[model samples]
Target: MKGNKGLIFLSLMPWLCMEADAAQHWADTSAGVRWSSSFREPYNPEKVSKTILNVTHVSQDDYGRNFLFMDYYISGMEDPSKDNATGAEEFYGLYRRTLSYNALAKDPIDSSWVKDVHLSGRMDVGYENTQLSPRPFKVRMGGLVDFKIPKGSLEWGLEGVYQKSYNGITHRHFEFDPSFVTWMSWNYPVTKKSQFSGILEYLEAIGEDGFGNDTKPLTIFRANYIYDIGQPKGFKVGVGYEQFNNKYSSNNAADPTNGSDQKTFVLLGSYHF
Candidate 1:
């Protein structure tokens, strides 16, 4: 994992250096960090928990009449279950790149019935070593289309992703054919510093094979209400609810369930600089 991360950094060196010149033409860059915790009830009898520390950087530039944007996320997770025996937990790393363009650059943002369209392609690679497996690697390729209609404060997007995996342990063979995902979201402001947003998405694995047979499609729905905590500093807080439905192929001795449903309540705090 370390070696692969090093290689990925080296490959992006040229582009990183070009940022200095690119800034002069047209570009914006920002970095932020986030921490999140997830909980499961039945499957995690002891309240099994994990922590994720993430850092994200994004850049956008304009070349002639086209637009370009790039985003990067680095995350590390700490698994409490794996720290029992060896007193050591595993860390995962991921690298992703995206290139995109705008389809309606000539239209004015305030024009009536005007629309903005964007098309993007992305690649992601990740590595994780868990208690059950020595080393696991996954690769995914995907494309997305985004549409923005400012007149109604609406945004929609569609995405298709294909993933392949290679397992390093014998009994833990894993494979996934392909998956398709689509989501639509809308934003509405109710007060001077408060807003509401809702999103619905469907994700499914296309076929059954190897470990893929054990995984099934998922439907997720989420709603959030956000309020500004500080007016001058740009700090905000959000409360949300999410629901999920997932199914597995066969039941194991430890866990035997064809399908399960869960609902989660989340609280988030963020500061923008």
Candidate 2:
């Protein structure tokens, strides 16, 4: 039953992405596909594979900026001998739209720096169905403030998001909490075909409901080296790593003893059209 539902949703994604728009108000729209596989060893060794298709459209108007984004994911492998009856281990869908306004819209001096200091808010809704969890609708409401320093290449911003879950299994009940994230990145050109960029982010989640014990604070650091293949609109590749740690208590019985020390390496390739 689950496999059949996943198949039906996957088939409808392309049409939704292509025909959902009635008014052509966005500046540009882009679509892409991605695939990733991971291997992990935490007392038990396992492998996970995922494929995703995404589409995004953004438009800017006198009032603010608007964006529409959608994602579909399919996981696990297909093999009759390897517990093939389950089909895939996970499948999920996410759809979100956001609107932001700039307060210093007409300012001339330091226009770029001034505009980043704007008041913005957004709402997001998503659905997920996986072998480990049942289907649920999730919603997030958030606000952000972006600002940059003058006379320097330094920029910074802060944002807070609160999320809640509805219509899910016992363990996947509704939880409302806020998270704060701050990020900094720098861009440097090393020759015309290559560039180096670095980023750092800190995130903290406030607990709510009985699920509070499972929440944690995390910090992520990333550095990337990008090389242009040939043309202006060609291909690029990147490599990075991510590390995770738990900051809050755990509600799951199995996770407390295991600790939440996890890490992953990432490799990426993409083309622009």
Candidate 3:
């Protein structure tokens, strides 16, 4: 079903990134793999292991910048995928376009703290091969305030979007609602060989879910301190702390222990090219 679509998109990502690199002023792409065994299953209280393969691309053109990332998740057999009847696999991706006010303005504002402002458009798409076989799609429109930092930068942004979701169990009968999201991201150099970076995002819940359960707000937070290994940008490794409360906006009424909350440490590695 949706997994087929996700597979096609993920397979073509490399080619798309290469084309964008040739057409953009500046472009960079990174491939990273991460794994964790501390994740919990929703509704059912049990620990499961998950591995993720992530590919990210960022490019700047005459107008502004483009950013995209795709994640492929493989879970243990305890949560088997519908397609394979074994481990579950999910694909999720996000694409963002930032139209810079400074780049288009006649006279750009040069304030001390505010580096630039941007009107941003974002799209999120995801598909999972679990029993539910959820397909979620959303489009966001918002603005971002970019601030300058010593040898680095930070971005604070907000988005308002409508979510349209379909699942195998509920089909298309579930209620769709609009949600507001706020996020912050920053990266700073701790030393020449080390850097601190992370992202914090909060999503306001919409209406009821597929099961008619009242959806809850979602919070995702990740902070990492990465150290460069060999060359300047060749190989890197880091450890990070991650937290997810009310993940996927699912309110675990069946499991009163809040089995959905995930606060764990993750090991990360990446290569930039």
For each of the candidates, give the backbone clash count.
Answer: 0, 2, 0
Write the residue-wise lDDT of candidate 3 on 1-273 in tens digits: 367447545644643454455446888788998888877667746667889899999887766788999999999976777775779898999988787888779989789899889887777889988778888877777889999766776999998866767778756635358789999999998999989999999999888888777888889999998989977558889998888888888775555756778888888999988
**Residue by residue across 110-181, what tens digits does model 1's lDDT show?**
434434444433345444444443333433334343444543356455666554445443455444555777
By TM-score, the best candidate is: 3
| Cα error, candidate 2, residue 151 (Å) | 12
Give the best candidate by lDDT. 3
Determine which window of 10 residues in candidate 2 has minimal summed lDDT: 39-48
Winner by lDDT between candidate 2 and candidate 1: 2
Better of 1 and 2 by TM-score: 1
In candidate 2 the C-alpha lDDT for residue 194 amounts to 76
lDDT of 1 at 204: 68
lDDT of each: 0.47, 0.49, 0.81
lDDT of 2 by residue, 74-125 (tens): 5555311124454343334444333334422455335645434333344455
Runs off by more than 4 Å, candidate 2: 1-30, 33-36, 39-47, 56-70, 77-104, 109-115, 132-155, 166-172, 185-190, 197-199, 208-214, 221-223, 247-260
Give candidate 1's error at residue 172 in angstroms: 6.0
